[model samples]
Target: MNVSLTSEPLRPVVQTRPVPPALIEALSQRFGKQLSLAQVVREQHGRDESSFSVPPPDAVVFAESAQDVSDAVKLAAQYKVPVIPFGAGSSVEGHLLAVQGGISIDVGRMNQVLAIHAEDLTVTVQPGVTRKALNEAVKSTGLFFPIDPGADASIGGMCATRASGTNAVRYGTMRENVLALDVVTASGELIHTGTRAKKSSAGYDLTRLMVGSEGTLGILTEITLKLYPLPEAVMAATCSFASLAEAVNATIQIIQMGVPIARCELLDAVTVRMVNTHSKLSLPESALLLMEFHGSPAGVQEQVETVQAIAAEFGGDTFEWAHTPEERTRLWTARHNAYFAGVQSRPGCKVISTDACVPISRLADALLDSVLETQASGIPYFMVGHVGDGNFHMGYLIDPNSPEERATAEQLNHQLVRRALALGGTCTGEHGVGLHKKGFLLEETGVGAVAMMRAIKTALDPDNILNPGKIFEL
Candidate 1:
């Protein structure tokens, strides 16, 4: 099980503060077997899917309950030591890096579905619950939670990153779906933000403030999420375009027409080839749009007809429909495996992924220009997008050992992000500004907004101990 992680030159220099002997003694004695100074366990908790590499945390604490998390934070706070919250370790933004070196509070064992208010269309769960687990737990209730974010990320991590994925085009992202959170603040005080009631004129909107804070503000102990009724009918189909521009245009028209498409993803020919090789299926090797519609039988048919017509106008060919749940699952599973496919496409290469979201109207301009630049660079890459909402990721596969390759990828990423910002879009759409994208945050939000963010960080986490060296630096 020893696999090498791809790393860039940006592997942060580990200038760690001393974990005082007294503090270590207190933690080891307080948690006993639950606490580990084991290097292997710390290594497992250290890195994430990001290509950026760094040293592991000094220690790891396996937290099983809300009280365990609160107590661990209290202990870490007493020593003024940095504490990083670890969930599924699925985030790709270096969200798990122990940049300043401390202890990692792992909550994966706290997996529990606390409550199911099916009638009220809400569910409460511990922070470690995964999206797939949540959907499975709620399946019998005729409801589903739709924010996917590709990986089977923990609900807490998903909320912290404000994640969205294939289904966000219809159901929205975590920011809209998350109702309430029971959070442990920087001072180790367990507080509740928001309520289960659908909408509220509540003070401060603290729930949302914590949602995308990237673990900078607090640790999420429990989360209450909004759920949606299962669509009466669901239909999925794939259509190939002569070129990416056509695919982009078709998506723009679909969104502009106000079609309630559940999922609309774009994959360039290069990506289709990788997916085909990985999934063991013969998908059309051209720019393609994978689309899904949800509604009544008649409504689904109408949408299908409309999108099909629009595709034909753009030289779409070989439109294929998935007639069974198994077929639809296969298609989406392949789609979700895109990152893995990209990595495997280039042996020993790591992905330096970019998250750029632009206005729907400007998607073609943003995406096509970036495509042209990447194609010119001759870097191995894959392009897939949740184009329904103008969000897409271009994964640059680069040789980790080649600093030049990494630099070229970063240059392309910078150009892509600047284009997105110019189009009135964001540097990061779903992936939070972890250590990787904090510089872009300043460029995107400007001096005043980032300063306000810093003020909030200072006010809430004056000790600067909660997941330090993430989002924005002090």
Candidate 2:
């Protein structure tokens, strides 16, 4: 599984354009207390959870409504300044960085659940609403939003990244769940795409386009998403395996057999050990598979039996069930905290997290190769995977002041991405191409496709003021 390493040359940094003082003054006069020029506030708006160097925005605007967002965009367009949209700041791919030094429009104040169509299994909300909040709001209706990306990310941010999580194997990602959006274009005009209906023969499918555009096309102000009914019966369990391949193979077999697994996650021995220490649990420090089944009681039992047989064939140990709701929450919370646990495992070290996905059959090859290479790289790292969907992430711990460590991590990322592409997979699965994977986009999609994307950017934004220097540079 180990592969030779080759370093890819880093892209040269493009100089950021300066913001106009007149625009800042005008915004200051209009927004008054809502506008902040404080150094700490600008710094807060500049970065997300990524290890990328922070480049704080020139100013931060606390937007409270669609009008606020529209007005800010219009002003930025007038002054030809970059507009970086800020959400929960949970993005790990440098999506929220103010790379071009513009005004960041903070939408956290606009959080609101607009409407819930319980009968139709759909809900509309302002972009700032978090997934947890949305679920709490609709809990009384015997329904819930299933798209959980680990973080309590803002709906706007989740849509921007087209995020998915452990449950994506069954429930799907944001791309499939989001039905409509009210977007503020580069010119500050609000336009609606798609509708509340379940199906549509839309003209341009602009809704899909904007879903993962990474704020380059427009700023999402309102979102309409599909919801699911709470399962009648739910069960979660963890199984230990002698090796990583065995765990991954068991998952592959379960998936290929068409078992309706609600969630199928793989955590390597290193990750499991970190989670155990961080979460104060006694999970065996072996390659592990965490699974969830959802259906009628009979259906759930059937799935558990099928999965148990599959796991046994791969030498997996007995399943340890989380019988109660509180136990299930604790299990998932530990899984979601894998990144932070990895960070805490190494004091004073920052993490460079990256993800890739391939066909279900290629999951083992991709993950094994990555794990082997990382182990040989002499880097401190933790690995986790959503094996049913063939997506996984590795977080490399490094000292922030060490350029050599940063370069090594970047090289490891380049090798992993190239391997994924060779296996007919994407450079990114859920995490969108922000600043980190811009070069790899051209490699995954050909020049012609990338050129078409650039053309679309030009045609829509024209001025290149909306989230400038992201995805593919103009």
Distance from true location, Cα of 251 in model 1, Å: 0.4
The TM-score obtained by model 1 is 0.97
Clashing pairs in 1: none
Q: How accurate locally, in lDDT, is each candidate? A: 0.91, 0.90
lDDT of 1 by residue, 223-300 (tens): 999999999999999999989999999999999999999999999999999999999879999999999999999999
Candidate 2: tens digits of C-alpha lDDT, residues 154-229: 9999999999998999999999999999999999999999999998996889999999999999999999999999
Give Cα distance to truth, residue 335, candidate 2, Å. Answer: 0.4
What are the RMSDs of all candidates, in order?
4.5, 2.0
- Model 1 Cα shift for residue 338 (angstroms): 0.4
